[model samples]
Target: MKKLRYVKDEGMNKKRWLRGGVAICLSAAVLSGCATGQDKQGSQKDLANSLKVMYSGSEDYFYQEFGMLFSAVYPNIELEVVNTLSLENTLLDQYNQDMNKALDAFIEQEQPDVVLLDPTTITSLIENGKLYNLDTYVAEESYNVGGFNPGLHDYMKDIGGGQVYAIPSTFRSQALFYNKDLFDQYGVPYPTDQMTWDEIVALANHFPTDGAPSDRIYGLEMAWSKELTEVVNVLATAEGLNYFNSDTMQMSIDTPAWESIVEQSNQVLTSDAIFYYDYIYSGDYEASSESSLGDPFLEGRLAMKLESNYYIDTIEIAQNNAQDPEDIVQQWDMVTAPVGLQNPDSTGYSMFYNLFAINAASTNKEAAWTFISYITGDEFARVQSKQSYGNIPLRAQYFDKGDGRNYAAFYKLKPINNVPAYHQVPQRFVYEFPSMLQQEFASISDGQLTIEHALSELQIKGNELLATEIMSQEELKLYLQEQQDVLGPGVITR
Candidate 1:
């Protein structure tokens, strides 16, 4: 029985790993190989008669449901989808061991026509030449690109090198979730879309300590994970510091922006307004004054938490599980992150989303492209919006069309305001910048390193990584030239 359990767990793990890996690998292999059925003498219809689509298991339902709609529009095509749902632990282990092999093997075997992938994963895969170029298809087809925010479209190009490699299906931005019940208890105004960081701090400071010194409420709870590093980047950029210059491939850390972040963090830490997790070693929040964001916020302990729009589903789940569901509903609400000086009244941030791309080497390129179009286009967006997919629709028109309950709730949630300057950085930079900033910033916040020491060390370590892991200037120039050749001239503007 023990052996049986181990075998079952192992099998489940393998299934999960294969789901993400196989889809990725198949998509990569298609970029390298010739289109399916091209060598066999046949008409366009014959070439597209049957095709296989490899997609992540998480996306299986979307493919099946929306896929039927696509077929209804064009019956000549047949899509056979393969689902792989690999365990997270297995993928992490593989990632540590170079991260490309399992995916490569899957691509070499299944040869799927279309694939959906996380944007960061796609960026790394693209760097290794594992995907197709979609320039020709995008140019020829009259896609409703106009509906997308121009900044987002431009950011996609910077990552895809003007090839339109993938279609942005959904997007997420970070926001501040506050407990309305706590505000009422403290007689504080609810945070607004236009609140500034200073204002947030002031609001946090107003919580009455009362006669008992130990009974103080914490103003904020921070997650401090690598994911929140984007918050740091946005804040830095808003303070007028450029962390990365994609044009010159230089990293600058010794700026006013960095200084501002360190100072602000210190203020938040030292202030009576907030109590961080590290402040209390006692894990029991009920026995202590401090709490982590998730626990405290859900239990009505903390006043505010910085979270992504994706947290809405989790919030809803927690609310459902509450002893009094009505109490949960009355307690929580989300607002955009505090505005910075540069973007005063606006949220300074960046976003990434899951996207669908066609296999460049598929024997059925046209059919695959058609399927991709249908999946990412208006019809699929509407259906996806209705399903509570923790995502906002990419198409502007679909925002108002879905069911009043789900879609309307999402619409009431504000769209994050972002600047063109914030969106211009390459996708690779966006992924790496956050973690690097977090590591260095955490050291400073923990008092393990001083501000100057942190900045200097960050520069040294960052340069070393850039020199070793990232392509050099000469290599990038050559790559850009090659991409221009495949995509035709003027696709990438300097």
Candidate 2:
């Protein structure tokens, strides 16, 4: 019997080692050679074969369990896994390489049969034509591609204008995870899936009270790190908002929609309904009040938190490692993140999703297809439902039977109708602008800037930066291709 391990942050892992699925107890070994398939009857004499897999910047448990599971099915194939710069977002960031000489390295180094890629990495590979189109293989196998959310398939094709380059195995989405005990203690019902942003904020209001001690529980706790941007990005995206207009290359932040997001967040922050760790721990939120703060949520000082699938393992690890069995943190579960007012039906956004793709350049396409097919299939879904890694499976069936983790709530509501393109722009100009927005949020917390002035200043400053950040199509294309290396002949330009 295998137990759960703490997962790293969600951005790096769509494979968010769930609490269920194949356990990683199998020596943490990877595929580097060939073997035979495992048989229920216990004979592998005829199933002898080989398959090589390459995955980078991921937990050893994923490969350990995956190797164990895949080997069991086709024990005859030697499952070799190459682990390298597997850092979640490092693939495209590997800009140090010229013309994607990285592909040159693959030819000289170990040529992997299958490459486990995140959306960004997969897109890069697709542009370089390093990936083989799985359409024919998918069709030949008549794979039940319908088990996943239709949007996933649509988004993958949309990226390449109808070519299936990568298969999505796991994804991360935001959810409202509440401390059930707190809700119960106050006789407040747990948050529902249909709750709107204001409704959830209203729910948060139920927690903090004047009579409570200085250690009075906070209403809601957001990770406070980068989530500020993520929350706003989700809202803005759902409303069809973008910081930079790709076509015009202009910045447009002075709008009512963006203002609503800032205002609502301001309301939540001021009302003490939301606790940002930095706003508190930085001695800022306490600049006015004698509020108690720390890793309040981890220390059991918070009643609720906004998180994505990535947070599951961290919380699980905390629960498992607590000094005393039941020191505090009552029962907790997640629900779909609240929807926006204007786009009340919008599903929130995730920074990235883990995608699995076959190496079109692999010599063993047949065996590679077998591996990719099985792992993304219902059979793997059945296997995944058995564990509680932080990552959520794309299949609905797994959610129906998953363990005690409340995995279903993560997907209880649909996500944004589409996956937004990975933003790769001038970090100094386009990206840093959001940080200014956060600063305004912080300023609002400090009473240093009025909300109106903050928005006005944000717009003015943003547009100034946009002038330098805008690029022509040729410039944008070059920017996208920077640091990219071709692993083989397969590449495409969007």
Go through the candidates in order and give each one's C-alpha lDDT.
0.55, 0.58
The ten-residue window of minimal lDDT in model 2 covers 284-293
Q: What TM-score does structure 2 among the candidates reach?
A: 0.67
- For each candidate, give its TM-score against the true structure: 0.59, 0.67
The sequence of per-residue lDDT tens digits that candidate 2 reaches over residues 352-457 is: 3556667667778777877777777776665665555555666766665345656666655545533323243343354356567777767766779876787788
Query: Best-fitting candidate, measured by lDDT?
Result: 2
Please report how far candidate 2 places residue 242 from its true position, in Å. 4.4
lDDT of 2: 0.58
For residue 327, give model 1's deviation from the true position in Å.
4.2
